[model samples]
Target: MTEIHVRDLRTADPADAAAYAAVRRASVPAMPATAESVAYTCVHAHPDARYRALVAEADGEVVGTAQVGLAHDSPEPGQGYLNVYVHPERTGLGAGSLLVRTAEEFLTHEGATALYTWVLDTPRNRAFAARRGYRASRTAQFLRLDLARAALPPLADPPPGVELRTAADFRDDPRPLFALDAETAADEPSDVPAEFDDYAYWLTETWRHPLLNHELTTVAVVDGEPAAFTLAHTDGDGRYASGMTGTARAHRGRGLAKLAKNASLHRAREAGCTEAFTGNDTENGPMVAINRWFGYEVFDTEVRHVRAVG
Candidate 1:
């Protein structure tokens, strides 16, 4: 008889990180992840988050993983999230169920009143979430672009008084970029309201993230002030992902965000990245249209599901 159980992932173990990353990559190819990034997340999560990387083992082999945590940045209390993925080859072995059960128990104990997760938009996945009593919410799409061959839009010169630079240019002081990011994040559509006032947390979690590629991240500066920016993440392989693209509220209608993204994508292709990926909420029509114009296609979709923890 096969036995399956879930436990907190050993963050410092390289092998554990590798196994967790392997399962995630095999389960969702569109989502780019690496051992280094996984380990970083496991170790660097905020204390308020009560974060846990849970792994499911079947006969002592890791085959499923989940990221469970409280939404520390949310304005509301008792909001939590848990995303689970199992190795495609190891499905039907009860690994996923064990992981979910373990994660829910942890979140409930952590004072979570609501639990949210993303389920791949498929019949089986949808049915599984439904059985778990999670009601469907918003939908998000994973978009991909052939960065190696697709004809990316030509990089255009910045308008007068506007200059283009990489994130590395702001290495001395990234506070401006942080402010812009906070504004954009606040404007983003989400079920849970996010507040980004903690600069220390932002520096630790976002700016210093392992996957961030400062050289490929483009920023638009207007008259020496940061206006818009596009963050880039790469796995040292050919895969590149747009982490975020946002224009300051004052800088809207100037095409600054689009300009920054185009510049970043061009730099990514030139840097030998073969594939580019990004995600957008279905409600974000403007961003979806921008990505569509960049030759990205919807490769997969995931529906956000939520349930109240009794």
Candidate 2:
């Protein structure tokens, strides 16, 4: 008889982190994840998040992983999330179902009233979520740019009074960037509303993440003040991804965000990165247009699904 079981990931074990990252990479290529990044989250995640990394094993071979957590940063209480992915070749082994059951029980015990997850936009994936009582919500498009070959737009001088800078320039202090990030993130469309009030948490969770490539992360300055920025992540294997790109409310419509991202892409290519990846909500038309203009092509889509927890 084949047996499938789920258990807490042994975060201290580098082998466990590698297995978790491998499953995630096979299941969702657009989302950049590495063993180092996985281990970092397991160690540095906010205490309030009640985060737990889980793995499913079939006859003692790891075949699936799930990231389960409460949306502790969200203004709304009881918002929980769990994303489960089974190795594509091992799907019929019942690992995915076992992981979901285990994750749901854990979240429900933590007082979650609404649970959300992302399901790949495929017939089988959508049906899997639907059968599990998840109702689809919003969709996001994964885009890719051939940074090594595509003709990136020529670098142009920043408009008068505007200067281009890198995230590394703020090594002495990053509070200003935090404030701008908080402002722009607040305006992002989401089912769970998040408030970035904890600077210490941001520093621990985001600013210090291992995948963050500070030298390539570009920021735009208007009149000596930070206006827009693009956070960059690189996996050291010629792969680069844009973690987040945003502009302060007061600086919108000035193309500052695009200017920063373009500059960052150029820097990433110059730094020996070959493939660039980014994602945008389908509802975010302005940013979608901007990404398209930079030659990013939509490669995949994911649907956000939510279910009420008792």
Candidate 3:
């Protein structure tokens, strides 16, 4: 008999976070994760989002996990997410299904009307989601750059009215950056739209995240206001990622977003980051072109899947 059972993740237990991180890293190396970051997210998620983390145990050994939450910031209500990952070597034991089943039960009780998730772009993975009644939607690509070996373009002088600054320069106030983020996020491609409206929540859940490398996060300023930015995150092991890079609608055509990202990437490389990673929606041609120009190559693709919940 299979001994697989799913239960709530014990955020206070060090082993839980480690096991969760292990499963994620083993299942999708292209996705970035750390034990501390996982725990921090569990502890800091906004209450209205109804965030819940679940772990599947096979005879007392952790084998899979699911992070379920509602898209509280989305203008359209009743949208939720359930991202499940099982240890690469521990699949085929029903852990993944069990995690999904348990997560859906909870989300349904929360009044979620629709569910969305990401499945790695592999034959088996895609088929699994299809069989579960989840239809494929938009696709996204994960790109990687050998920061230590690639030749980055020379830094270009900003336009007369634009200036480049690191995130740390806005220590006294980050509201302007928040506005820029919200504006750009509204244009991102996704099955469920996301909005950034809660300033306090954003400060705790994002700005202060342990992995957020403020010194390496570059911002483009126009007339003393944030116009574009590249938020940087590093795991302190020489691996860095551009968590988000966006240009406000008002600053879209001047290449300020590219300038901000380039500045951040240069700083990350100098800080011993041997590799850098970022992702973009397949429909986002402009950003995709920018990353390609940055010497990044698409290494992995993930397909979004959606299902209606009762």
Top candidate, metric lDDT: 2
State each candidate's clash count.
0, 0, 0
Q: Is candidate 1 or candidate 2 better by lDDT?
A: 2
Q: What is candidate 3's CA lDDT for residue 277? A: 90
Instruction: Arrange candidates, best lDDT first.
Output: 2, 1, 3
Error of 2 at 173 (Å): 0.5
The C-alpha lDDT values of all candidates are 0.92, 0.92, 0.90
Candidate 3 structure, TM-score to reference: 0.97
lDDT of 2 by residue, 240-270 (tens): 9999899998889999999999999998999
- The TM-score obtained by model 2 is 0.98
Report the Cα lDDT for candidate 1.
0.92
lDDT tens readout by residue for model 1, 1-310: 7899889888789899989999988887777788889999988999999999999999999999999999999999999999999988988998888888888999999999999999999999999999999999999999999999989988899898899999999899999989989999999989999999999899989999998999999999998888999999998889999899989889898989999999999888889999999999999988998999999999889999999987
User: Which is superior by TM-score, 1 or 3?
Assistant: 1
Provide the TM-score for each candidate, comma-separated: 0.98, 0.98, 0.97
